[model samples]
Target: MRVAFNVIDETIWFIDRPHEPWTVQAEARAAGRLDDERLRLAVRSALARHPMARARQAPWRFWQPGFAWEIMEEPQVDALSIVDCPDDAALARIRSDLYGHPVPLATSPPLRVRLAHHAAGDVVLLGVNHAASDGLGTLRLLASIVRGYAGAPDPVPDVDPLAVRDLRTPLALDGLPGRIRHAAALVTELRRPKARIAPERAGDGPGYGFHLVRLDAGDTPALGSRRPPGATVNDVLLAALHLAIAEWNAEHGAPCERIGVMMPVNLRPPERRNEVVGNFSSFVTVATDPEDRGRPETTVAAVTAQSRRVKAGGPPGALVDVLATPLPRPLLLKEVTWGLLPFVLERGLDTAVLSNLGRLGEPLSFGADAGDVAEVWFSPPARMPVGLALGAVTIGRWLHLSFRYRHPLFDPGAAARFATRYVGALDRLAA
Candidate 1:
C-alpha cells in the first residue's frame, strides 16, 4: 500500500534538516517493570494495527507528483530498545543522546520506542517523525501499544488513507469570497511584528535541549480557578506563555515587541478521530497588547477574548488554502521554503508555540506486570526561527510541562531558567 504525503506532511518533510529534525516526543512513566520481550511483541502488534505508522517514504521518481509512504509488513529495524538507566543522571544522558538522533524517514515505522529502566521504575520514550503523525496521533499509537501489552484486543479499523489526508477544515471556506477573506487575514498576520528569544553566542552545538516541570497535582485545579470567566485552562496557559516570553526577553535585555504565539488547533473531528493518524491540525496565531504583558489579569482577559474570537471565526484554513494554490514541484517547494524561511522567521513566525494536549482522556495500562502509567509528558519539536516551544499534557492529577528549545537559541542552563520563569508566571496568575 502506498499513501502520498499531504500538504502539512510535505511542509514538515521539506523543512526538516539534520540539525533540526521535525519530531514529537511522548514519555510514559510506569510504576513497575516491563518485560522486554513482552513490550517488543506488544509494540510489533500495535504497528500491525496502525499500518500507516509502520511505513517509510517510497523512493520518489522525477515524474511523481508528490512523495508517498510505502507501507511495509513490519519495521525494517527493531523499533524497541531496553536501556539500563541506574539513576536520574544516567537516564537524562541516555535520553538526550537518543533524542538527538532523528527517527529515520527511510526506515519503516519512522518512530522509536525505548524503555529506560531506572531503579525507581520504567520510563518509555516514544519518538515519531512529525511528517508521519502529530502529537495526538502519537498518543493514539501509544494507546494501541498499551492495550496490546495488556492482553487486550486492538482490532485494526478500515481507514481510507486519502480521506484522512483531506485538508478541508470543519469550518472550511465556502467560496471565492471566503478565500479572499482568508487571504486578507493572512496578509494582516504577516504584517504583524513578532518577537523571539535572542540566540546566545555560546552553545554546545545544534540539537534539541529540554527541561521538564510538573505542576503539583494538588495545585492543578488552580489553573482552572484562576482563569477569567469563559477562559479555559488552555487560554490561561497561553496567556502565561505570552507574559513569560515578554518577561524573559525583558530580563535578558531583549526588546519588548509584540509577542505572538502559534497554537495548533486540532481539526480531527470526533467521527473520524480513529481513522486519521497523521498531521490533522491547523494554526491560529495568538497575540496581545504589549501594555497588558505586565498585568497578568489584563493579559489573560485579552488572550481569552482573542481565543474566543478565533474559535468563533472558524477553523483556520491557511494550510488548506496553501494546498489549493498552484505551486512548483517538491524540489522547488523545498528550495523556495528554505529560501523564504529567514524572512518568514523575522516577520511572520510566532515568537513561541504552546501546544496543550489538555489531558490523556483514558488511562494507559499494561495489564498488571508493567503496571498502569503513572504520568505522561510530551514535548513538541522546537524548530528554529521560533526556537522555543512549550508542550503540556495532563495525566492523573499532575500537569507535565516540557520546555523544548534549540541549542543555539538556549543552552540547558538558560532553558531551565526560562522554564522557571514560566512557572512563576503561571503562579502569579493563580495568586
Candidate 2:
C-alpha cells in the first residue's frame, strides 16, 4: 500500500540537509554478544510487523502532486551488521560513526542496526531517519525487534498512517477558530526576546558529538523525591536543564536573559496507542523569565506552571493545528521554514530541545542464550541554533541520559564540561 506524507513529515523531509540529517538514535548495552543470524532474522521480522517502518520513499518530480511512500515486503538493502570491538575506545568510535551517518531514504526500511562486540560488554545501536519516525516510534520498533528475537508475535496490526496523524494534538479545540486563536497566542508568547547557549567555539560542520551518562537505580528515589507539591519528575529535569544552562553561561561570561526549551509532546490518543510507525508529536516551548533564573527551586516552580499550561492545551499546541491545514506542499514548506520557524530560530525562542522518552516500559531480552539489556539510551538530532538535544529514558529504575551536540558549537571537551554541569544541577535538585 502507498501512503501520502503528512505535513509534519513533509516539513522534516524538506529541511533534511546532508550536513545535518534529521536522525534519531537508540543504543543498548548488553551483557554478551548477540548471534548475527538470529539478530538479522529478528530485524526483518520486526520490519514486517510494522509495515510503515518498512516504507521506501516513492520517486517524485517537480510536476508531481506530492511525495508518497510505498511499503515493501522486505528491505531492499542490508540493514543489520555485527562489528567486533576489542576495546571501549573502538566501541566509542563505532557509536560516533553510526550516529553521524544519515539513513538513506531511497532504500526500503530506513533504519540502521549495528551490534558492537566488546570484551567488557556488547552494544546494540539503532538509528532511524527522523523523517520516518520520532524517538518514541523508534523505541516501539526497537521493542518489536527484541520481541521478534525472543519468538514473540507482531506487536500491532497495520493501520492507516493518515488516521494516526490526524489524532496528533489540539484535542480540545472546537474547530478552525479555536486553532487560530491558540496558534496566535503561542506566536505572541514566542515573540519575546530569548537567550541562546553561547558556543564554546565557532563552526557549523557535519556530524554530531555526543556523551552518555547513567544514574544507578539507587539514585532513582532521589530524582523522584523532592519535586514541588505537584511537579512531576519531568518538570524537575527541565528545571535542572535550565539551571545548568544559566550557570554554564554565567561561568563563561555570557548573559542569560531568558532560557527556552523546545520540548516534544506525544499526542497519540488511547485508540491509536498501539500504532507506532509515524511522527505523532507536537512541540511546546517552555521558557524561564529572567527572575526565575539561577535557582533550582524557583526554576522548578516556574517550569511546573508552564508545563502544566502546556498539558492543559495551552499555547505550545498551536503548531499542531497550523500544520494540519490542507495546503499545497510547496507553499506549506515555505511558510514553515521561511515564515514561522525563521522567526522562532532567529529570536532564539528555543535554546535547546529536551525529549524525555520516560521509560522503555518493558525490558528487552534477546532470548535465554543471547545478551540481556543492561542499559538503554536515545538521542535526537542536534540541529544548529538549538544546537543541543538532551534525551532521557529509564530501564527498570536506572535513568540514562544522552547529550548530543552539533559540530563546532560544542567540541568533545565542551560537551563533556556542559554535561558535568547538568549532572551537578540535577544533583542539587535531588539534594
Candidate 3:
C-alpha cells in the first residue's frame, strides 16, 4: 500500500544528548555486553541484512546515505545542567527547535547518532528518523547489528526492499458503498456519546514517567483462556482494557457507556513480511459501548468478531489503490485531498488507540554474548488534539504495554493509576 500522509513526512525525531546517551548501557546489562567494535560491526551487518537500509528510491526510500555523528568529549558546561533531565522534557525542547531547523528537501540528514565518551566510558545516542522505521524495525536493526558482532550468519533470507512489483495494488472495493453503509449501521449500534472521564489523579503533576513491568510466562495462562476457537493476546488485552475503563468510569461517578479503540492494521501481505520499512499500515476503530459490556463473555466475543471484520474490510488506502492506476497527478491529489481533508480538519475521529503488533521474532542480540530480548515496549505519539495512545507488543513470551497521553490532558500519576487498574482488571478476569 502507498504511504499515509503522516508517514510521508518524517514523523519521528530524536535528540542526542551526551549525558544520557548511555541509557542503552543499562539495556545492555539486560541483553548482553556492550563492546564498541561489536556495536559498529552490528550496525554494518544490519545495513547489509535489510536492503531498505541501503535503498535509494521513492516511497520505499528507507535510510539516508550518511548519518549525522558528533563526538562530544567535553560538551559545553550549559549542557551539564540538562544532563539529568527527563527524556520528555528533552524531546519538547527538540520539538520547539524543529521549527527553525533546516530540513533539506532532496538530501535530508540521515539518521543521526551521537557518540559521547567521558571518564565513565562511551555511550552512543542513535536517533532514528521515524518515517523510515518503526519500533519493530529499530529492534531488528539492533538485533542484526548484534548478530553481526558475533559473526552469526543472517537468520533470514535477504529480500529486495523494492521487490514488491505491485505493492501499490489496492484490495478490491467492489460493493464498497454497501460495505460503508453496513459499517455505518454497526457503528450506529455501537455508538455512545463521549463521556468526560475524570482525569488521572495526578493530572496536574510533573512530566510522565515510564516504568517496565514483567509478568511471568507461566502465569500467562491464568490471565484468561483463549476464546473457544482461538483469541489472540491482543484480544484478551483489549477485553481487559475495556473492563478497566468501564471500572474507572464507574468509580468517578461519570460511568462511560461505551469506549472505542482505534486499532492499526498492517496492510503488507505475508509474502512481503521481510521488507522492513516505513508505515505501510492503516487502521479501523473497534468500539465497545456499554451494551457490549453487559454480558462480559459476550463483550469479549463481540469485540473479537468486530476486530476480525475491521481487519478484513480494507480502509482508505485500499481506495487509494484503485485511483492511483488511472487518475493523473492533479486528480489524484484532489482525490486524496477530498478523502483526508475532513479527518485532518476534525482531528482524528477516534477516542483512543490500541495498537498491538503481536509477537516480534527471536530475541534480538547485538554481540555473540548477547542474551535474548526479554521484552519490547513501543510508546506511540500522542499527537495534539488526540489525547491517548496505547501500544503493546510481545517479545519472547512477555507482553509489554505503554500508555501515552498529552501533557495537557493527562499527568504521569494518572497514567500510572490507569495502568495499575488495568492490570488489576486483567488479574480479576484471569481469576
Worst 10 residues of 1 by lDDT: 315-324
TM-score of every candidate:
0.93, 0.92, 0.67
Q: Which 10-residue span in candidate 3 carries the lowest summed lDDT?
A: 19-28
lDDT of 1 by residue, 1-431 (tens): 88878767877887787787877878887789988888899889878877667889998765556788888987899999999998988877766666667889898989999988887879888888998988887877887877888898665446665456756545346766676677567557757778877665437476687788988746754375554567788988898899888888878799858888888877776665534568887777788768877688888888888788767776443544554453576565656765685676467677888888887766778788878888787877867778888999987778899888888788778888888888888877763
Query: Please, what is the whole-model Cα lDDT of each candidate in the order they appear?
Result: 0.77, 0.77, 0.47
Cα deviation in Å at residue 418, candidate 1? 1.2
Residue range 29-87, candidate 2, lDDT tens digits: 76776778887898888887776679889887754656788888888988998999988
- What residue runs in model 2 are displaced by over 4 Å at the alpha carbon? 63-65, 157-162, 167-172, 201-204, 220-222, 271-275, 314-317, 326-345
After superposing candidate 3, which stretches have Cα over 4 Å from the reference? 1-29, 51-127, 155-158, 163-167, 173-198, 201-209, 222-229, 253-255, 272-275, 311-348
Report lDDT (Cα) of residue 143, candidate 2: 78
- Overlapping backbone residue pairs in candidate 2 total 0
lDDT of 3 by residue, 1-431 (tens): 12232221211222211211101101112243345555555565556566444322132222332122221222112110112213434533432232112222122222333322322322333333444454445445555654675677667535544443222443345555644554454344334344434565434322223433456544665343523344556776777777777887788776575576666566666764534544455445566778888755656776778767666765532322322333223433444544553354333245566766666655654444555444355544434334566767666667777675655555666767877887776665542
* Candidates ranked by TM-score: 1, 2, 3
Over 4 Å off, model 1: 153-162, 169-171, 199-204, 272-275, 316-320
TM-score of 2: 0.92
